[model samples]
Target: MNQQLLSQVMASCVNAPDWLMKKRQLAVLLQERFKSTPAAEKIMAAWLANPSLAQLEQSVGEQTNADQVKAAGLHTTGWVNLPLFTAANAYPELLQENLMEKAISWQDSQLNAMHLALLNGGRFIYIPDGTIVKEPIELTVDCSLPNYHNLVIVGAGAQAAIVEHQTATGRQPAYFGTELLLGDGARVDYYQSNRFSAVQNHQAVRAYQAQHSVLNMYLALFDEHDLTTDFYANLDGQGGAAEIKMVTIASGQQVQDVQTQILNHGPHTVGNIVQNGVAKDKAVLNFHAVGKTERGAYGANSQQQSRILTLSDECKGEADPVLLIEENDVNAGHAASIGKVDADDLYYLESRGLSEHDAQVLLTRGFLLPVLNQFPDQKLREKLVDELAQRLEEKHE
Candidate 1:
């Protein structure tokens, strides 16, 4: 939060582009403007007040090596990938076209501004126009020192898939921001797995879609920490479509606030949001899902479903679904609920000779089945299912 430390961090980036520097400066101004604003969520107040600004400052002058980055699971093949800061400094042309112009908004929140100003590590992935990538781009994050901010761009008519994993680490504060921009007719299937060891983690993902473009985002969160996530999709061009689905498991006294927003701003656009979460062992989970159809968006459609199941008496959960319809020609509706597991289903499973714990695990999986079915990769679905079962059993034991 000190000016001297911020200056040192900015100076550490060697030969960074002037435009990028201007962005950093704008972020600082935004941070100042929102300093007095309270976090929207009460649970995140303390964490947002001191969200690892010092950690980002400490990362100044540190150099990343091929070996270290590989150890962190950052090096990948079969796609155009580069270190985030390195890409900004060395290859500005790749990002100059549409970096923050549409993907991210610095004026959104103080935390967002701080993220851009203190960003020190991440990856940039680019998919050229008309290219069809047969395999999903795989990425992992293990090093938490570098406040990571990733950017991904998909050119017109391109189709690609991306999967990112966050491995366990220390009990440190961590921040990650990823913005995806899709050109006209582009299609992207993006998935994220959050299982990091940070005591407090802040994450955000935003997508900007052009005409006739499509974006599907899937999030599997199992972080046993205080976690706040912001996921958004903007259908900015005619005929654009976007769907966001999230499945989260909160256990061991964890607190999670997950917000997903979709805006239908173009004619004939479509947007959908589905979120499911399970809370056990005194954990708390809150889901906020919003679907909005802007004015002049004739024939736009928006729908959302948010549900949460609390498995323990001490555990708490909330599902808040909001719908905003500005155009009379639009169609929008939402469903939200926070409830306990169904007893009849559990009884039926137990009658089939399954133990109570086994039956509960199966029921949990079934609750998340809707979102699971939306994943494009079958292998990933199986993997996540197994991981979920194992984690549930471990927590119960």
Candidate 2:
């Protein structure tokens, strides 16, 4: 690591505690393990020259207060009330060990300017081996600046399960990036929901899974915004499994681009992806899912599916599912569909004395329930369902 870069990172973290400063120093020292890839260098440089803590504190203070934000019926909890501090304190050991083991890497070539900023921004999380945390962990990323970047890293070990919820609430144009690593025999369950009002930008996430590990992710995007999300997972150990499910609702000139990839590198690995999207009022959504199996990954099984429901003549949706198989013994397939709701299904529901609007809402809720059903926390699941209902009402109105 360059002395100039070290000095820059040190200066940027002036307000951070001594322990965090030490962690940063350790991260810099560990960066040498990865080949000096361009992406890695860019991430390191940006982190070094990142803004000072005082500046971030002031920015947080100057943001629109919780009581001032207005988005449909969505209410804002105070910054302190959000789970930022708890998330920061929860996973230090997990991330530190991954950083030490060279199991994590960064790529700037795939990053946009906002991504670069997000990489330099936000808090960090880590989870160690045999940690069985049942409570869902939640965090809110509020961007007060016109353009900002935030990055979160999670590491899970053997027999570990974790749930994370991230929400973004603010008016500023923003970029967000997240990278997660699951160690051998680890089990992780994760969920994220994003709602943006009067914003234009993208959000990206990438994760890597090791041997005998399992990962499940649920995502939801509602309201008017332009978003591009990229997700990549590498199954590096035999018997590893990855499941990704997403639901997106868009209205009023919103556009969303989704790209996902699952790579099978170990024998007998398994991967599955399921997604549902709805576009209305001139909204457009593009979704893609890809599964790739290496030659050595014999007996690997991968399946991907994407379904979209269009509610307006002016709305458009595209679904793409791709499979790349290098081993003849592997099992891999993809399914995709983009269309309007079934008129016959609606007619049948209407015959049961349900109003058209009520029927539509009921059907939409049913379409999303499969993903929500995977949540282990009953309280969180109910809260999310209520939020979804509120957003759906806004769309109808």
Q: In TM-score terms, which candidate is top?
A: 1
- lDDT for model 2, please: 0.62
Off by over 4 Å in 1: 35-79, 168-170, 344-356
Candidate 2 regions exceeding 4 Å error are: 1-114, 117-120, 141-163, 344-356
Give per-model TM-scores.
Answer: 0.86, 0.71
Query: Cα lDDT of all candidates, in order?
Result: 0.77, 0.62
Error of 1 at 71 (Å): 23
lDDT of 1 at 210: 95
Question: Could you give the C-alpha RMSD of every candidate to the true structure, in order shown?
Answer: 4.7, 9.3
> What is the Cα-based lDDT of residue 133 in candidate 2?
48
lDDT at residue 107 of model 2 (Cα atoms): 28
Q: How much is 212 displaced in model 2, in angstroms? A: 0.8
**Clashing pairs in model 1?**
none
